[model samples]
Target: MPNRCQRLLAAILLFAAPVHAETLLCHVTYGGETQDLEARPVSSPYTVPVQPIGSYFLFRIVFQKEPADLAAIKLYVFADRDSGPLPIQQATHPYPPLAGKGAGFGFTGLNQVYEPIRDGELQYWCEWSPSSGPAR
Candidate 1:
């Protein structure tokens, strides 16, 4: 009893419904952080913060690759979590206030960090030859 056009349209729509299928995407990692890519590609590189330590000694961190999509940082010289801050701290034992003459607290080596690819919350990390800490 329906018109030809209406019947034809209904038949087309019924056949056009989407079929459900599950696909796995590659997992992504950066500076030691990982996230599931949901069968899709991530559009940006993950970033993390690195703090320098102690002015008493010069500190340096050599990234295997600058702005690496995901990399493993190597720590050379002064092994352990307590040698010296990456940038080297100047010993602010007496956290001097007001004047800039006090020792500046800092970390002293190479570290890895992973930022959460999530919304609303974030993650940060700091690795020092002498010490390490997690920041949220």
Candidate 2:
């Protein structure tokens, strides 16, 4: 009986594990699916200090693991009041590596560019909206 249960458990563990990608953009999964993600404190987990000069957004994206996986995550800072469901940011990046044995990994910097709205408060959005996820 115990042997049967062990075999079942091993099968479940092997089949259930997600198929991690080959390339290492981030050392862990960002959310789960939806490939893209917003540059927020929660979703991003890591962050960097801002110099505060040109129009830019500074954020650090990290996944703790054996090796630090890093890449450029796209971000768009918008006028908060700018409406149409939600404020938006376009992300263009290669998918990161999966977390090895420890945590995940990623990168951070001020996205320098002004994709502006005329008049509104400052708000932002990316594909990976962690808001929908359970709080950590």
Best by lDDT: 2
Residue 65, candidate 2: how far off, in angstroms?
22
Best by TM-score: 2
User: Candidate 1, residues 39-96: lDDT per residue as tens digits?
Assistant: 2112222332222222122222233333334333322221113453333122111111
Whole-model lDDT values for every prediction:
0.28, 0.32
**Could you tell me which 10 consecutive residues in candidate 1 have the lowest summed lDDT?**
88-97
lDDT of candidate 2 at residue 38, scale 0 to 100: 23
> After superposition on all CA atoms, how large is the RMSD of candidate 2?
13.4
Model 1 spans with C-alpha error above 4 angstroms: 30-136
The RMSD (Cα, Å) of candidate 1 is: 19.9
